[model samples]
Target: MREHNRTIAHPGTREEQMANQQGNQAQGATKKRRTFLGYLALMGPAFVVGAWQFGPGNLTTAVQAGSRFDYTLVWVIAVSTILMIFFTDMSVRLGISTPTSLITSIKGHLGKWIGVLAGFGVFGITLMFSVGNAVGSGLGLSLIFGGSPVLWTVVCTAAVGFVLAFRNVYGIVEKALLVIVVLMGLAFIASTVVAQPDWYRAMSGMVPSLPPGSEILIVALVGTNFSINAAFYTSYGVKEHRRTRSDYRDITLVDTIPGIVAPGIMTVLVIMVAAAVLGKTGAEAGTIGALASVFTPLAGPTGAMVFALGLSGAAFSSMIANATAGGTMISDALGRGAKAGSPTARIFTGVILAFGLAVTLTFQASPVGLIVIAQSLTVLIAPLLGVLIVIMANKTSLMGDLRNKWWQNLFGAIGLIAIIASSIRLITTLLG
Candidate 1:
């Protein structure tokens, strides 16, 4: 038999039209996926900073703010987050502009001592953070597993040390922290949903009240939420990822704003939840256990578990970022190296971990106090870092087109004043 002619649909035929629509849909889907992945690729450095900021210390202050003052302190988180985005954006620009790490660039533009001092200052702040991280990691695990907080602290520290001991440390740290931040966000959001916080009152909390006797808690909240040191570290992350000036805008949109805001929103949610569940009954969440317990009556065991998970995730992620940042900065300060995988950086990181463990073990009786104190102490050193970032970001020689605009400088100055005022308040509170 002869070959038969094959049937074909005309261009305007139903079959042909359906195929065209399907092709267009497939192309659209593919483009959307690629765009999302592009954003994901830019997500590392900022999320790591967010994880570091939202650690146990942040959780503690937010809990206290909610339990003690209800949502009246939510404005602190909101303001701090906005200021944080400005500082982080500056750092991102610096990262794209500088030829070396942030500290190294400081050494180049400022004095050597200033660079070393910035590094040491950051290291000192991280040391304070480590204490809270150690206590928090253990306490969170204990709340979930019914074990000694000290034991879990040890386990968490060791695990973090092992993770940091490897090569490509920044890459590992960035990816791990991104995952942790997402999980922490979900847990807090879920807990908030269960708590059914008072929406009207919570909104009113955004009106900015001092609420007599809220000084220390407010200081701690700003310390953990604004976190100039964390913002300072963002430049290092940008350098590590080899980002360029062209990538700056995208980084701010995808990474910096969301990364910083994630923790801030979570903090606000925590405050709202605590106000609803704990403040109403005048129950104080003085410890992680206490915080978790507040959730139990409102949503039962599941609620407590969710809060615990968020706490544990925050602690663990902060533990990693805190140690890594301390190690890297100190290493850069000492002229050893800027890479987290460097031998000197790793050594310093291990020392930070050990220091936190030692301090936690020594002061096992008053973890909540230690966390608040540690967090507040961070505010004292933050003014210097904030000033340094502002000065560096304004240098036209370095930042070129990416230098701080008038708006950035405006907010940067505001943030600096806020941090300095917090420092002064903390000093007076401690002395009194």
Candidate 2:
């Protein structure tokens, strides 16, 4: 133990360095295993792609699909879900290659102008994630235990923030959200099974068709929810997990599959419920509250209670996701990660929550408000991200040998076109 040590700045032996690298890589790989579970056991910390898709916004989409169009737009969600899967694969592939985030990578690859535009688009996503999650949480809390919706929302957010503020927030959030999603998914599927609608219409839904003039809004709405952004977030989430190129392909499957399957299944169940229950009534009801009311008489008090609980969970989980992504985006934009209870971190969550709360509290708007904005914004972001992904994937150095398959590119291109077309329709409707 002689202290004749080397204090000089000197490189370690090559073997020593390699060993350290391998050790670090092993630690990272362990984290990756947890990350894989993170993909499956999605709860409160971050979001699972479909988790947002099935939230309060989806309630609106499902309700309207039945209230207005019957199950004519059912296929929209199906088509969008598959597209989301494909695009999510592309995003994970590209994001894993770049050191930056999915958004930053898009910025780096796309020119300044395009990058800047996409950055603005991320703002809209911030709003969607924050408001969506908070409102959903509040709604879930309200359903589970009756209280002021706003009060419940803030309380739930604070509670969640409390958990997220802790060191081990991931597991808690993951388990809770997964339970919520499973509960919601099961209940909705039960409802769908209980009431089987016309298979003919459900099948016909897969075949895309433009309805009469303004009626196309339903299709646009469905398209909006099921589109590319779901996949884009998956890639971002994968990167957040610190996965490598080897993880890319599998990550895409693990991430996008749930995102696609959950929402797509939920979509079918919602459409089935609508077609069976309210297709003839043609109710203008678009809120989760309305669904609860409907369930009360039809399925009884328990049904209403459970449905409300699901809605609340959907909204709250969304808030968690929104805050997580929004905070990350803000920090990334400002070049700071949302670590613990920093002022900048709280602000990231707070800013988005305030924006959503203003709309919800002011107009007494329902979750549909998030959808109207969220979907439209994604309509823009999805296409832009899709194109950027295709571009990035084509660059051989980025993807290396495991670049985009021919089919991935084809789907990516189709997704871009679909998103752009949906954007045009959304804009036209807004202008008119």
lDDT of 2 by residue, 1-432 (tens): 232243122123223334533543454454345465664533222236566556666666676676566667776777777777776667666655655565555444454456556545665776865665666666666766888777887677666666566544434445566676778787776656544567777778777765564256565565546545445555556554666644544555555466467767776677667666664334544555665666655666776676666676677666655565555555554545423234565666567767766665665555665656766677667667667767877765445555787887888777777777777877787678
Local accuracy of candidate 1 as per-residue lDDT tens digits, 1-432: 122222232213334324533443344443233377787798889898999988887887888888889889999999999999999989987877676788987886688999999999899888878988998899899889888999999999999988998899999999889888889999999998998889999999989999999987888888889989999999989888877655666788899989999999999998998888874556777656787897777778888999999999999999999999999999999999998989999999999999999998898887566655665557556888999999988876566566788988999889998999989888787778
**TM-score for each predicted model, relative to the true structure:** 0.89, 0.79
Top candidate, metric TM-score: 1
Candidate 2 global CA lDDT score: 0.61
lDDT scores for all predictions? Answer: 0.85, 0.61
Looking at candidate 2, what is the lDDT of residue 160?
62
What lDDT would candidate 1 get against the real structure? Answer: 0.85
Candidate 2's TM-score reads: 0.79
